[model samples]
Target: MRHAETVTFGGSALNRAAELRGDKADVLALNENSRSIALWRGKPLICGTNLDQLALLPVSQDLFSEADEPPVPPIFLGQSEDGSALFAHDISAWEPAALDTAAMQQFVDPTQQHHPALPDDHRFVELRGVMAQLSARDAELAATARSIFGWHRSHRFCSNCGAESRMAMSGWQRNCPTCKTSHFPRTDPVVIMLITRGNKVLMGRSPGWPDGMYSLLAGFVEPGETLEAAVRREVYEEAGIRVGAVSYLSSQPWPFPSSLMFGCAGEALNEDITVDPHEIEDALWISREDMLTVFSGQHPTMKPSRKGAIAHFLLRNWLADRLD
Candidate 1:
């Protein structure tokens, strides 16, 4: 947790410039004047690509192509120290391609694509590789794009007035035509923790995860609940572990449909795990050494957490004695 900001995407100190969101003229001018820029789905975009993922897109193409092409909302990622534009694309429009594992696999497997234009640094490729090879920033960008775009597609109607809303503020907000209400993009807070007692850490596998894959216990923070309380409640509700002394570790923007995962390391007061059949298929405590084996691919029944996820980062640092 101490070296959290040093963690891949977690460390890129890009200037998000939240204060400038309202300055429409200056933003438009900056986008037009930016030297090194990337176009996502046609809106000008920027992001501090500390890792070379931004160059993965096949030559810059207008994000909004074709007369009938749907709108692609562009998010202002941030600016580099040299003032270069850093941006991200909402490829959630291409979600169907990602959800279809077969199609997604083809994009990553270099030998399979008949005419692959995507770069190796692309999120789709790095996701398929072994852990630690992919930078956390790239993963964050991909996830952000997917989640935000997915939100736009799903929340086209205003909840307050049942009227259609339009994309505004560079995909960061939506404005309802009927009630004149402004809705901002949402990142649901989720608590993902490594519940440890002695040398064993608690992990669980969801019903849909690939076979042998297990991760830290996690759940969304309910309305009006504090983060610490959410961590305690989630650990107990999902794994039946009574947690005490919850400590925040790190946070990651998980774009898998718009979520912000808050990583934590908590002290477990109880060892007995009564798995919630609805929340998790199975749960167990794995020793530190066993976790190392899992990380090294020596464990046959379990696969480590997804590379770009905060769970994987937390577990890796925890194993490396760097999470203290």
Candidate 2:
């Protein structure tokens, strides 16, 4: 795991200026040097001939001040390399006339939305489709925005008292007036294990995943459960394979809806997969030789894991014998 942080969405050491979160006067002073990234219904505004650059507009960009102020206020994402303030705004209020809701819910949204006021090349695209191509900084900013915005959207009503809460601490926290309670954004922990026995690794596909799409078996870490226990329990529960000697690998901030994925390595005691039909549609062990074929697009039935995901990162390292 020497190069653990090298994983996409893992390496950028962005200077998150948490000290300024509660400083109203200093936060106001940021207007002079702040830049904002935008998200429309979770898709970030990106513009590049190759579609690799994230759109970091001036905080006062005219489009942001349109008739409808962004329902979710701008979130302070911390500072950039040059010490300039960085923030993210969710302009989910903008309604696209030809939105493909179905496509949005699929494995990866292929459709891009363009705002009438913005240039045609400047479009909001799904992060999953372009994550591997983005620079480390862009990937971090985009992930941070999508996760916090999704939190605010779903947690508008206070969980403690059922009262509407207000955004606070530069969108890092929510305050409930009636209950006088403060809540912070929560990232659910998920354990995605690289379970292996001999030269083969365990791979599984969910019920509705696209044909031939498979990834390492994963499950949420239950409360009071350690990462090691979660790895063992999940593999057994989903694929009916007992695992032992779990070890940590790299991790990724997966923002499909806000999840911190713990990529771990595990030794499988048995490969007799009695797949829990409710947990996964199928699970099987693929040898190192066959996996390489999948990675090179030569396998006719099993597609490689998505490029930007932690599963792919772990598998790539494992194949290269770098999982030391």
Candidate 3:
């Protein structure tokens, strides 16, 4: 677990200036050197020929006028190099002439969007598609923006009193005037397990997943459920396997829809497979030797898990015996 934070989207030490969230004057003054990152429909605007650089647009750009998040001010991401501020703006309002809705809905959207107002090289690309290539800072900023913005979009109304809420605390909170209630962004906790028995590891594929796509078993932590309990219950519920000696290994911020994945190492008590059709389509144990083949893209029947995901991170480190 020493290298846990080295996982993708984990190492960035961005100074999220929470103290300034309530200080309007201090935040406004920082705008003198403030630059904002832009997102269009959850995708971050990245530049450079290799698309490894995050595009930091000027705070006073005219493009902000066209952004949909008007009443809700740009999210204050954090402090950047020197004394400048970094913010996130959502420009999902602008409609592209030939937007491919189908591509946008795909599990891994490969589409990119370019704004006429921005430079030719600066295009909004799906975060997951380019997450592995981005720097730690860039990855953190993009993931934060996507998660917070998605939360605001889906939870516009107050849960306490069914009244619409307004963005507050510089996008960190939402305040409902009618109910005088404050709501904060929510991150669902998920436990992804690396369940092993001897030289083999357990893997499963959910229904509708692309053929040959299999990953470590994972499930959301229900209310009042502990991490260890969640891992055990999920494995049994999904693949009918009993887990013992559950231990934390690592963690990752999975922002596909705002989730914090707790990676855990668990020992499987029994190897016999009994997959639940309601939870997963299939389950099986793959020998350590065969897992290496899957990782090397030589497995005849299985494809590699997404490289930037925590599943891939846990499996790769397990293979190299780095999960200390």
* Off by more than 4 A, model 2: 25-30, 67-71
The order by descending TM-score is 3, 2, 1
Return the candidate ranking by lDDT, descending. Answer: 3, 2, 1
TM-score of each: 0.78, 0.97, 0.97
lDDT for model 1: 0.65
Q: What digit string (tens of lDDT, one per residue) describes model 1 on residues 30-127? A: 45444222333311132223333434331134432321247354555555566644454443343222234464444233221111233433233332
Report the C-alpha lDDT of model 3 over 89-154, residue by residue, as the tens digit.
Answer: 888887887988897888788898989898899999999899999999999999999999999999
> Candidate 2, after superposition: displacement of residue 23 in Å?
4.0
Of 1 and 3, the candidate ahead on TM-score is 3
Better of 1 and 2 by TM-score: 2
Query: What is candidate 1's TM-score against the reference?
Result: 0.78
lDDT of 1 at 194: 78
* Count of clashes, each model: 8, 0, 1
